[model samples]
Target: MRSAAMRDEPRVTDAEARRIAFAAFVGTALEWYDYFLYGTAASIVFNRLYFVSGDPVVATLAAFASFAVGFVARPIGAVIFGHVGDRRGRRASLIITVTMIGVVTALIGLLPDFAAIGVAAPILLTLLRVFQGIAVGGEWGGAVTLAVEHAPPERRGRYAALPQVGSPIGTLLSSGAFALVSLLPADAFDSWGWRLPFLAAIPLLFVALYLRRRIEESPLFTELLQQQERSSSPVVEVLRRSFGRVLVGLSASLLGVGGFYLLTTFAISYGTETLHLPRSLMLGATLVAAVVEIAILLAFGRLAERWGPGNVCVVGGVASALVAFPVFWLIDTKNPALVVLAITAGVACLSVPYAVAGSLLTELFPPQLRYSGVSIAFNLGGVVSGFVPFAATAVLAASGKQSWSVALLLVGLSVLTALGGAIGERLRIEDDVSAA
Candidate 1:
């Protein structure tokens, strides 16, 4: 069944590539579903049920801060999981991270509301969120490395992008779940409806674990083992040899990571509270946007193969900055269709940079240190991006609820990513020359 051109492809068989892609894509999707479900719950359920503040806005802010608390723990997770991933094997790290995320997420479902457990409710929720943060912080580097390292050199761009596709899939599943549950009568929804989505993580966890187990370890990592070239301390090694590139990678990722939460998480609060949009309408718009995002990400992933990932990402970064103001303008109109248009525009701009990020960043470090380098850079970026919802909310309050303030934040972030992408392009060239 192989094409004439594919017959000469190097390093990996088509069948093995397909298997690696499926395992990475599906496993990351399940983990992200668990992570994003918390964001959805933060906007709707957690503020009311866990925080229990006298003022609605105050409760919302507190809930968002709790969400940020998860990011605060990510670097720690990255170090712990990154070391394990680099030293032991990608398969073992994945097993631990996925299990941690699934268990924490399901426990969140079982947690009592403020009325039942009082202060203990919010405290326990924050702790569980921290565990979720650690698990996911460690999850991405291993997942992407497995896919990228298993791929043929020529197809690395496309294969690496396969894992990036997981974000939209996760968003779609989480938002779709919320949208369906948003249908219950207000009191019923407030009581137990939200828990259903969290509890649903159990089955997804099993499937993802099963898929991950069936896959082989990264061929590149296997080669490292055969050569007896594994780093004694990958975290330390990456920092020693590639710290600057790691910082550049984190900067490049800011727009995709932070701006996404700004649009989705902060936008949800803005839509419901300030614009008076129905929760269903907002969730529905996001659901549609998630679908739009998947298409855009897939298209961009393919485009990266032709255009070059850095060139494509540069285009995306600049475009995101340009579109920021108009997208917010559409949202301000409060029409459901316009809101969908606004979010779709945001996703369109963001997807290009995101689709190629795994491949682009993967090239920055040598294989022995790749897992650690990527993990540290990415989780640190998460630490920064993780605060977007909290910071955007404060900025909105300070600016008298003007959406432009948030739009401006997006513009600033997009510009940083563009500059970082340009720098990364230069670094990538240097890496290529050195490897050559």
Candidate 2:
């Protein structure tokens, strides 16, 4: 079935490349579905499930603290998995990371109630989250980089965007599950039904793995391997040489992704409690935003191709900064239509930089150190943003200023993200293929 030109084309056939991209999409989707599902649960379910505290604010902060633990663990996971990925190959790294995520998530579903385990339950839950963070920490950089490196230069934006597309796909699936489950009685759902969403991810991971196995090492990575040009210490080499890029990349992702987790992840709570909106209404807002997020992500990739990712990000950040305050004010209005419009607008503006994050970091380093650099930025960004919800809550509690606080915070971060993107554009070149 091979074409004459394909005889010397690459390690993978054209059909195989498509197969790999699909696999990467599916795997990334399943991982984020599980990952973000926990965030959704932490925002809604964890306060009741883990903490018996009568105080809503205390419980909310505790749930967020637990959520933050997952992001904290991601950097460590990146370090361990980054080494394996660079020293080994993208294929082996994914196999291990996916396996870990699949097992931990399913087990999270099976975990005993706080009442049954007493103090041990939340402690155990935090530990499991740590592992989940670690698994995904290593998984993303490898997944996106593999797809991007294997793709042709002209198609790189769309190809890289393929795995990036998985974020919204995953968000859609996970958020949809929570939406469906919300239809159940609150007591019943809290007691047992919430586990179903987490348990649901196992089958998806298996399918992702099968598809991913068909992909070979990237041609660029293969050339590096064949030449034996890998770094003596990839982590060190990346740190010593690429540290500035990593810092910039990490800072860029922090505002958008962190802002996202705060808005989508923590805002779920904000809408329900602080704003006193319905769970379905807030989730509906997230679903709307997610749809727009997908559209924005897809089109923006083409836009980035035409205008460069930096300019696209600048436009996005400016939009986020300018509109954030009014958007938050509208959401707190308790007017359903207005709230929906605000949510959609807020996330769409934020999606600009986030949509391009994987590609930005992926293109920053050489093949061997790419994994290290990307993983560091990704994990660190999560850590920074992961704490945003808790910090937002505490700040709001102290200042009694939920609306303006969130708006100004998100807008400020967006401006910072745009600044980072501008810096990256000026300083770095797109990684070109080296002579084999």
Give the poorly placed runs of model 1, Cα more than 4 Å off. 1-10
TM-score of each: 0.96, 0.94
- Tens-place lDDT per residue, model 1, 341-372, is 99888977887788888887877777777788
Instruction: Go through the candidates in order and give each one's C-alpha lDDT.
Output: 0.86, 0.80
Error of 2 at 196 (Å): 0.6
- Please give, for residues 18-93, the per-residue lDDT of candidate 2 as tens digits: 6677778888888889898888988888888886578999988998899999999999888888888788888889
Worst 10 residues of 2 by lDDT: 1-10
Clashes of 1: 0
Model 2 residue 22 lDDT?
70
Error of 2 at 198 (Å): 0.8
Best-fitting candidate, scored by lDDT:
1
